[model samples]
Target: MIEQPRHIKSIPAYKPGKSSVDGWDGPVHKLSSNENPYSPLPSVIEAMSHAVATMHRYPNMAAPELTSLLAQRYAVDEHEIAFGGGSVEVAAQLIRAFAGAGDEVMYAWRSFEAYPILVRGAGAEPVQVPLTPKLRHDLPAMLAAITPRTRVIFICTPNNPTGPAVGHDELRDFLTNVPERILVVIDEAYGHFQTDPSAARGIDLFREFVNVAVLHTFSKAYGLAGLRLGYAIAREHIQEGLRKVAMPFAVTDIAQAAGVASLAAEDELMERINVLVAERSRVEIDLAIQGWNVTPSQANFTWLELGDATDAVSAHLNSRGIIARPFSGEGIRVTIGDAAANDAVIAALADAPRPSA
Candidate 1:
C-alpha cells in the first residue's frame, strides 16, 4: 500500500458538471461546462486538418509562431509569454514555479474549482477568502486575509460558477496595496466573453504592474477546448518560471495551427460571440420573468444562487434533459449555450420549485 501525504489526501478532487441525463434518451442539452456552443470555424478546422499530416513529428516546443503572433497582438515581448496545454496547466506551472510547502496561495472561495487543487498539487497552502454576499470577490476581505507567507494570489474575473467581474478601479486599488514581491495572477480564461466595459483587463494591468501575470485560453471564446491550448502573459522573469515548469511540447502542432487560424478568423468569431451574448441576455431576461433573481453576468454563463435548494433544482433540470453545472448545496452555473439549450434550461427552471429563502 502506498502512503499518500495528508495534504494531498485532504485536497478535494474537482468534479466536473454532468454531460448527460441518466436514463434519458431524448435530446440532451449539456450546459454543465461553459463551452462555446458553436463549432470551430471552417478555417480553424482546415488548419488542424492540414497539421494532421505532421502528427508523427514532435510539436514546436517553443511554439514560436503562436508566441510571435500573440506577442504582436498583445504588444508584449515574446519572452514575456508562455504556452501550456490549457490555462489551468499554465496556472499549475505558475504555482509550481513560485510556491511550495509553507508558502500560501490565496484566491476567493467559490471561484474556479481548480484553484485549490492546483495550489495543493504544488504543496502550497490554499487560503480561500470567501466572496461577498453578492457572490463577487471581496477585494478588501482578501487584502485582510493576506499574510507574510502569501506567495501567489489568483483573481478570477467574471469569476467561475458566478458571473460578476471585478471592477477596474477596485482591482487597480487592490493591486496597489499588494506587496510587489507577491505574484498576483489575473485568471482571464473567460475574458473574451466579458461584455462589461469597466471590467479589469489583465493585459492592460500587466503593462502597469510588475508582479501581475495574465492567463488566457483559447478554450472558451475561441472554441478550442478540444485542442487544449492556453497561454500566460507576464514579466519576462515570471514567464521564464512558467516556461521552466511547463511540459515539453505541451501544445501540440494541431492545436498551434488551430490557434493561428483562430486569430486570423477573429472577426468571424466575434460575430459568433455576439450571437451568444444576445442569447445570454435572453436567458437572463427569461429567468427574471420566471421569478428567479440571477446575478447579471458579463461572461458566457449565468449563475443561480440556489442555496439549499440546489440539489432539488438540479434534479428537476435533469428530468427535463438539461444537464447544467450544479455546485451541490451552493448554486448552479449554467452555460449560456445556444438558443435551444438556453430555452430548455429556462423552461426547466420555470417548473422548478422556488429556491429556499
Candidate 2:
C-alpha cells in the first residue's frame, strides 16, 4: 500500500459555494462566493476577447506588462511584485516558500479557511489563535503564539465569515513585536471594499515592514473573479522565494490583459465597489434592526453570528433562493450582491426566527 501522511489524509477539503439547491428550481442568488454583482467592464471584456485569439501560444511566463502596470500603480519596484492564478495560489506558494515539516504557521481561528489548510498541506503545524470577544483578530494573542518554530503568520483583515477588521495601530504594534526574520503575510483580498479609515492597509504595511508580504486579488472589487488573477508584494528575498515556488505561467494571457484593463478603469471600478460597500453597510444595519447580531463588516460580505442556529438560518435563506455560506454551528456569511439579491437576503432574515446562540 502506498503510504500517506496522517495529516494529509485528515485534512478537510476546501468547500466552494453551492450553485444549486435541492427541491428548488428558482433563480438562485449566489451570495456564497462573495463575488461582485457587476459584470466585467467593457474595456476589460474587449481586452480579454483580444487575448483569446492568442490561445494557441503559451502565456508570458513573467507577465511583464501586467506586472509593470501594477508596479507603476502601487509605486513598487517590479521585483517586489509576483503574480499568480489568484491570491489563494499565491498564498499557498508563500506557505511552501517559508515553511515546511515541523515548522509552524499561525493565524486567527475562523479566518480565510485556507490558512490552516495551506499550512498543514505544507507539512507545518497550524497555530490558530481565537478571535477576541468582539470577533476581531486577537493580534496580541497571535503575537504571543509565535515561537522559534513559527515561520509564517497570516493576517486577514476584515476577516472572512466574521466581518470585523483589525485596526491599524493594533497591527503596527503587533508587527513591531514580532521578530524581523519571521514572515507575516497580510491577505487583503477584499481591501477595495474597505470603508473604515483605520483598517490596516496591507500595501502601506508591505512598504513599511521588510518581513511583510501583501496579497491582493483582481477577483474581488475588480469583478474579475473568472479571470483568476492576483499578485503579492513583498521584500526582495521574500519575493524571490514566492517567484521560485510559483507555478510558471499560472496567470494566463487573458487574465493579465483583463487585470491591466481593470486597473486602468479604476475610477469606474471604485464606484462599483463603493456601491457594494454601501449595500453591506445597509445590510448590517438592517440585520441589527431585525434583532440579528451582525458583525460590522468592511468587506463586500457581512457575517451573522448565529451560533447554534447557524444551520437553520442557512436553510431558511436557501429555501428563499438566497445561497449563503454557513459554518455549521458557528455562523453564516452573506455576500452583498445586486439589489435584488440584497433584497432577497434581507427578506429572508426578516422572516427568520431570532437565532438562538
Candidate 3:
C-alpha cells in the first residue's frame, strides 16, 4: 500500500452544507452558510456581464486594478494589498509563509472551523484556546498559551459560530503584550456586519501595527460568495510575503471586474447591510422572548446553545426545509437570511417543543 502522510490521515475532510435530498419537496431555505440573502448589487452584475466576453484571456496575476481600487477605498498603499480566491485562501497563504512543522499557530476554539484545519495542513501545530464564559475569545488566556514555537495568531473579531467580538481596547492591550516577531492575523470576514462602535475593525489595527495583517472577503456582505474574491491589507513587507505564497491568477477576470464595481457601489451595499442588521435584531429579540439562550451576536448570524439537543433541533429544522449548521457538542448556528427565511426558522422552532426544563 502506498503510504499516506500521517498528518493528512489525521485531518478530517471539510464538511460542506448539503444542497439537496431525495423526497424533500418542501421549500428549502439554506441558512447553513452565512451568505448574503440579498441580490448582488446591479453594478457588480453589469461588470461581470461585460467581463464575460474577455474570459478567453488570462486574468491579471497581480490583480493590479482591483488592488488599486481597494487601496484607494481602504486608504492603504497599493503595495500593501494582496488578493486571493477568498479569505480562506489568504489564511492558508499566511500559514504557509510564516508557519512550519514545528511552529505553533494559535486561535480561539470554535471561532472559524477552518483555522485549526488550515494550520495543521500547513504542517504547523494548532493551539486552540477556549472561549470565555461570554463566548468571546479569551485573549489573556491565548496570550499566556503562546510559546517560542508560536509564529502566527488568528484573531476572528465578530467571531464565527459564537458571535461576539473583542473590544478595541482589549485588542490593543493584547497586542501590546504579544511579542513583536509573532505575526497577528485579524480575520475580519464578517467585519461589514458589525454595527457596534467599539468592535475592533481589523483595518484600523492593521494601520497601527506593522505586524498585523487584516483579511476581508466579498463572500459575505458583498453577496459575491460564488465569485470567490477576498483581499488582505498589511504592511508592505507582510503583503509581499503573502504574495509569494499566493497562487498565480487565482482570482478570475470576472471576479476582479465584479469586485471593482462592487467597491464603487458601497452606498447601495450599505443599504442591504442595514436591512440584515435590522432583521438580526428582530430575530435576537424574538428568540430571547421565546426563552432560547441566544448569544448577543454582532455578526450576520445567531448561535443557539441547544447543548445535546443540537442534533435533534437541526434535524427538525431540516425536515421543515430549513438548513442550519449544527456544531455537534457546541450548539447550532443559523444564518440571518431574508425576512421570509428568518420567519420560517422561527416558526419551526416555535412549533417544536422545548427540551425539558
Candidate 4:
C-alpha cells in the first residue's frame, strides 16, 4: 500500500445518515440527516432554474453576490464574511488556515464528529473535552484543556448529537479566560431552531470578542442541504485567512443563486421552522413519557442516550422505516421530520421495546 500521513490515515470519515426506506417496501420517513422536511421555496426553485442556464460559465469564485447579500443581512462588512461548500468545509478551512503540525485544535467530544477528523487532517493535534452529564459543553473544563499550542476551539451551540446549547453566561465567562490569540468558532448550524432564551447568540459573542467567529449555513434552515452553502463571520484578519484557504470555485452558481433566493424567502422558511420547533417539543415530551433518557432538545432533532441498546433500537427504527443517526453503543439522534413522519416515529417507538440504559 502507498504510504499515507499518520494523522490522515487515522482520521475517521464522516458518516452520513442512511435513508430509512432504503430496503423497505413502504413509504419511508427519513429522520436521519437533520434536513429541512419542506421542499425549496417557490422563489428558490425559480432562482435555481434561472441559474442553470449559466452552468457553462465558471461560478464566481469570489462569491461576490452571495457575500454581499449575507453582509447586508447581517449588517456587517463584506470583507468579514467567508463561505465554502458548507459549515463543515468552512470548519476545515479554519483549521487549515490557523492550525498546523505541532499546534492543537480543541472542541467538546461528541459534539460534532467532524471536529477531530478535520483537525487531525490538517496535521494539528485535537484536544477533546468531554461534555457534561446533561450533554452540554463543560465550559470550565474546556478552558482548562487550553495550552500554548491551542490555536483554535470549536463551540457547537445547541451542540449536535446532544441538543442542549451552551449558556450565554458560561460562554461569556469562558471567552474571557481564552487567550485572544486563539480563534473560537461558534458552530451554529442549527441555531434557527433554538428556543432557549439563555442560549448564546454567536453574533453577540462575535461583537464582544475579536477572536470569535460565527458559522452559519443555508443547508439546515433554508432547505438547501444539497446546495452545500455556508459562511463564517470573523474579524477582518481571520476572515482573510479563511478566504486564503478556501477551495476555489467550491460553491456552485446554482447554490449561490439559491442562497440569495432563500434569504429573500426567510419569512416563509421561518414559519416552517416554527413548526419543526413545536414538533421537537412534542418529540421530547413523547420520548420522556416513553421512558427514554431524552436530553432536552433545543435543535431540530432529539437525542436519546440509549446506552447499550443503541444498535438494536436503531435497527428497530430502520425496520419501521424511520431512518435515524445512531452511534453504536452511545445514542441515537432522530431528526424531527414532517407531521406524518413524526407521528410514525412516536407510534413505532411506542410499539417497540423501550431502550435499556
Candidate 5:
C-alpha cells in the first residue's frame, strides 16, 4: 500500500453545478453553471473552424498574437501577461509559484470554491476569512488575518455563490496596509457582467499596486467556457513567476484564434451581455416584489440566502426542470438564463414554501 500526503488526501474534490435532473423528461434549463445562454459569435466560430487545419501541429506556446492583442486592449506591457487553462488554473499556478509547505494562502470563504483546493494542492495552509452577513468580502478582517507565513490572498469580485463586489476606495485602502511581499490576486472571472459604477476594476488596481495580479476568463461574457482560456495581468516579475510554473502549451491554437475573434467582435458580444444584464435586473426586482430578500447582484447571477431551507428550495427547483446551483445549508444561486428560463425560476420560487421565521 502506498501512502499519500495528508493535505492531498484531505482536499475535497471540486463539485461543479449539476447538468441534469432525475425523473424529468421535460425541457431542462441549466442555470447551475453560470454560463452564457448564447453560443459563440459567428466570427469566433469561423476563426476556430479555420484553426482546425493546424491541429496536426503543436500550438505556439507563447501565443504571440493573442498576447499582443490582450496587451494592447488592457494597456499592459506584453511581458506582464500569462495564459492558463482557466482563471482557476492561473490561480493554481500562482499558489504553486509563491507558496509551499507551511506557507498560508488567504481568501474569503463562500467565495470561489476552487481557492482552498488549489492552495491545499500546493501543500499550503488555507486561511479562510468569513464574509459579512450581507455576503460581501470583509477586507479589514482579511487584512487582520495576514501573518508572517501569509503568501497569497485572493479577492473574488462580484463574488461567486453570492453576488456583491468590493468598492474601489475600500480595496485601495486595504492594499495600502497589506505587506508588499504578499501576492494579492483579484479574480475577475465575472467582472464583465458587473453593472456597478463603484466596483473596483482589478486592472486599475493592478496598475496602482505592485503586489496585485488580476485574473480574467473568456468563459463568462465571451462565451468561451468550453474552450478554457483565461489570462492574468500583473507586474513583469509576477507574470514571469506564473509563466515559469505554467503547463507547457496549456492553451491551444483554437482557443487563441477564438480569443482574437472575440475581441474583434466585442461590440456584438456586449450587446448580448446587455440583454442578460437586463434580465438579471428583472429577476431581482420580481423576486423582491414577491418578498424574497435577494442580494443585489452586479454579476449575471442572484443569490438567495435561504439558510436551512436551502435543500427544500433546491429540490423544488429540480422538480421544475430548473437546475440552479445550491450550497446545501447556505443558499441557492440562480444564474440569469434566457427569458423562458428566468421565467421558470421566478415561477418556481413563487410556488416554493417560505422558510419559517
Candidate 6:
C-alpha cells in the first residue's frame, strides 16, 4: 500500500454546497453558494458564442488580452496581473508559492472557510485568529498572532460566511505594522457588491503596498460564476512567482472572452448590484423585526446568527425547497438571490414557527 504524507492525512477537504441531490423532487432555490442571481451580461453571452467556433484551438496561455484589460482597468502594470481558474485557485497558488513546512499563515477564523484548507494543503501551519464580536476580522489579534515564521496573511474583506469587512484605516494601520517580507492577500471576491465607502479596496492597497496581493473574481457581481474566471493583482515580482506556479492555460478561452466582455458591461452590472444591495437591506430589516440576529453584510449574502436554532432553521428552510449554507453550530449563511428567490427565503422563515417567549 502507498503511504500518504502525514499532512494529507490530517487535512480536511473543503465542502462546497451541493448543486443537486438525488430523490429531491421540489424546486430547490440555492441560496447556499453566493452566486449572482442576475443573468450574465449580454456582451459576455455574445463573446462566449463567438469563442465557441474556435474551441479546436488551444487557449492563449498568457491570457494577454484579458490581463491587459484588467491592468488598464485597475491602473496597474500588466505584469502585476495573474489569471487562475478561480480566486480559490489563486489563493492556493499564493499559499503554495510563498508558504511551506514550518511556515505560518495567519487569517481570521471562519473568514473564508478555504484559508486553512489551502494553507494546510501547502504544508504550512495555519494561525486562525478569532473574529471579533461584531463578526469583523480582528486585525489586531491577527497581527499579534504573526511571528517571524509567518509567510502569508489572508484578509477576506467583507469576509465570507460572516459578512462584515475590515475598514480602510484599520487595514492601513495593520499593513503598516506588518513586516514587508510577509505576503498579505486581500481576497476581494465579493468586492463589487460593497456599498460602504469606508471599506478597504484591495486593488488600491496593492498599488501602495509591494507585499500585498489582491484577488478578484468574475463569479459574483459580474455574473460569470460558471465560467470560473479570477485574477490577482500584486507587485510584479509576486505576480511572476505566482504565474510560475499557476497551471498553464488555466483560464479557458471562453472564460477569457467572457471576462473581457463583462469588464465592458460594468455599468449595467453595477445597477443590478444596487438592486441586490437594496434587497439585502430589506431582508436584514425584516429578519430583525422577526427577532433574528442578522449581521450587516456588504456582500451578496447575510449571516444569520440563529444560535442553537441554526439546525432547526436550516432544516425548516430546506424542507420548504430552500437551501442555505449552515456552518455547523455557528449560524446559517443565506445568499442574496433574485426578487422571487429572496422573497421565498424570507417567507420560509416567516412561515416557520417562532420560539416560545
Where is model 5 more than 4 Å wrong at Cα? none
User: Tens digit of lDDT per residue, candidate 6, span 294-325?
Assistant: 89998999998766677888888888788889
In terms of lDDT, the poorest run of 10 residues in model 4 is: 348-357
What is the Cα-based TM-score of model 4?
A: 0.97
Model 2, 1-357: lDDT tens digits are 998898797677899988788877877999999999999999999999999999999999788888899889889999999989999999999999999999999999989977878888988999999999788999878888889999999999878868777898889989999999899999989888887899998888887889999999999999988889888999989989988889987999999999889888999998998889888888888889998988898888989888889889899988888899999888899999988899889988999856653
lDDT of 3 by residue, 135-190 (tens): 99999999999999999999998999899988998998898888989999998999
Query: Model 2 residue 100 lDDT?
Result: 94
Candidate with better lDDT, 2 vs 5: 5
- Which stretches of model 3 miss by more than 4 angstroms? 353-357
| C-alpha lDDT of residue 266 in model 3 | 89
- Quote the lDDT for 52 in model 3: 96
Q: After superposition, how far is residue 152 of candidate 6 from its true place, in Å?
A: 0.3
Regions of model 1 farther than 4 Å from truth: none
TM values, all candidates: 0.99, 0.98, 0.97, 0.97, 0.99, 0.96
Clashes of 1: 0
Best by lDDT, which number?
Answer: 5
How does each model score on lDDT?
0.92, 0.89, 0.88, 0.91, 0.93, 0.88
Model 4, 1-357: lDDT tens per residue?
A: 899978889998888888645577777888889999999988999999999999999899777888898888788888889889999999999999999999999999888888988999999999999998989999999999999999999999989989999999899999999999999999999999999999989998998999999999998988899889998999999988988888999999999999989888889999999999999998889978988789998888999888788888888888888899999888999999999999988988886656653
Q: lDDT score, residue 202, model 2?
A: 87
Report lDDT (Cα) of residue 253, candidate 6.
Answer: 94
The alpha-carbon deviation from the true structure for residue 288 of candidate 4, after best TM-score superposition, in angstroms, is 1.5
Ranking by lDDT: 5, 1, 4, 2, 3, 6
